[model samples]
Target: MRTLFSKCLVAPALFASTLASAEVKLPFTLDWKFEGPSAPYFLAVDNGHFADQDLSVEISAGQGSLDAIPKVATGAYPVGFADINSLVKFLDQNPGAPVTAVMMIYDKPPFAVVGRKSQGISTVADLEGSVLGAPPPDGAWAQFPVFAKENGLDMSKIKVEPVGFPTREPMLAEGKVDSVTGFSFSSYLNLVRLGVPEEDLTTLLMADYGLALYGNAIIVNTDYAEKNPEVITGFLTAVAEGVKDAAADPMAGAQAVIDRNPAGNVELEAWRLKLALQDSILTDYVMANGLGDIDVERFEKALEQIAVTYEFKGEPSVSTIFTDAYLPASELLMMK
Candidate 1:
């Protein structure tokens, strides 16, 4: 009995040592704080998806969507989650920065103008005469110009209140602002958390109102990816697995987030995760074509729409901004 017990202990220790030695350390940066949307990556870590790929990924929270672009470009992080539209402008400005989106996570895009019905902001037209609270650095705010132009909203009539992320929802809740530009999932839930009734909240998702732009994606350091192509492929495979597992049981994903951020309310975050999965991540196209891939023609049209509001030094190409080269098989990307 003593001999058998000692052998079992020795075997586990040896296996653990092998795992530690073989694991590839890859630090990943996120577009925002540890929240419901961030749960899948945490699930991947907790569920050993990354381990299955021989990767040891450490996730770091970012200031905003644009924050991770420079981080990965500078090689501070080999992988990151960020807004792909922001990446288009970043690449255009930087010229040759070694960063590109490897996977498409937010297929429908979450950009929206969230307002309180009590504040007289029930529709897009209501925004013209009201105060719209917007964080200058927010990904949703960045695309508001296109939304306004598409809906024939005259910017001159709208009162633009530049508020910080922390103050955005509070200001809206306090009736200091008529509306706010933010992600549909984030802002709606934030308001609900602050004691606003669901019926009182009016969400005008940009994607629903003529905006065809894609949303956040997993970006990779091109320099690193070139040398470690297999690592990139493996990393994406693990991420897909995480997304599939999380979608099947969203509460599990929410638990993973709460485990990391104990301050978060599990029920609220679980709802947020569900919103992101149902409204943003899993779309008709993603369901049919599988995840991590984009329609090239639609993407080109999105760039054209962006050009209407943003001046470019050079033309942006879909190939340069995003690639499926690092994506896993179609079967792997299909959500369960």
Candidate 2:
């Protein structure tokens, strides 16, 4: 990881002779498990992408993407990554949580329905009236019904079966459910790794069906961004660079993550991550535009729907739900 950034840096002696540097501290509340898809965030730290912009960051795990929003709003973390749905809920429930979005991370939402070709199921339409598998607690299938209406899907027609977590891959192979709902980056790729031929499987993207909403995002407290705008901007700039690097070379990023772990399945995690990058939408969507990028207009559409679902009681617009000052970096990183 150090080697990568060093390749891009100007010679130290010349840079030192000409420039001035300042140190800044920042805290990040991670949106996923350590060394998973969030590996790029670790890459950003290990490779000094944060340091290049005079920002230093401390990263800690978050239970779910949704959980990060409240933590950032409360100042437990100056900035964090989260899903679009939860942040909207937080704003409606608390009315005082000052969270806002930084950038849109996954251009194509990661939601998908997977089925084995051998099972004779090959499309989202096939799941109509068919049994569908879901990860019990946070399974994408359970998230399906609430998000389904937006996609023009008839969620009531489908039978949802609660499947154990981390078992979707094999269960699909064994014909447990006709299809399973999950993120392509995590669960689906696990199936591919276990020798499920891509040609023998069908993946139907939920986003194509109108379930299009931002999945991962970088978030910060609106108050902190208002006061220390530059620091937030620099922090996101570094994070974006890290996202870019991860896309260009996931192996390096995965290795960087593996290098950080002290014990327990380092190699297994690394291999799985590499497979995830190869088959996941993460690289194709997020790589080109940079990471943590959010579209307000797109977000507003989903936010309105969720607020109505949760009975926000007609509170307010989602425009104030997030801030982009940090991730866009339209100013500071470009300025002298």
Q: Please give the RMSD to the true structure for each candidate, in Å.
A: 3.1, 7.4
Model 1: worst 10 consecutive residues (lDDT sum): 327-336
Best model per TM-score: 1
Which residue pairs does candidate 1 place in steric collision? none
Q: Which ten-residue region of model 2 has the weakest summed lDDT?
A: 327-336
Number of clashes in every candidate structure? 0, 10
lDDT of 1 by residue, 185-303 (tens): 98999898899999999999999888889999999999999999999999999998888888988999999999988998889889999999988998888888898999998899899
CA lDDT, every model vs. true structure: 0.91, 0.68
TM-score for every candidate vs. truth?
0.91, 0.80
The sequence of per-residue lDDT tens digits that candidate 2 reaches over residues 1-336 is: 468668557577567754544566788888766765677778888888887877778888778866787788888888888876667666777777678777655566566777776776776666777877887666355357655666556878888887877776777766777778787656656687778787877777666666545566678878888899888877777766776677676667777766666452555565656545444435444444434555567667666555534677446565666555455544422211
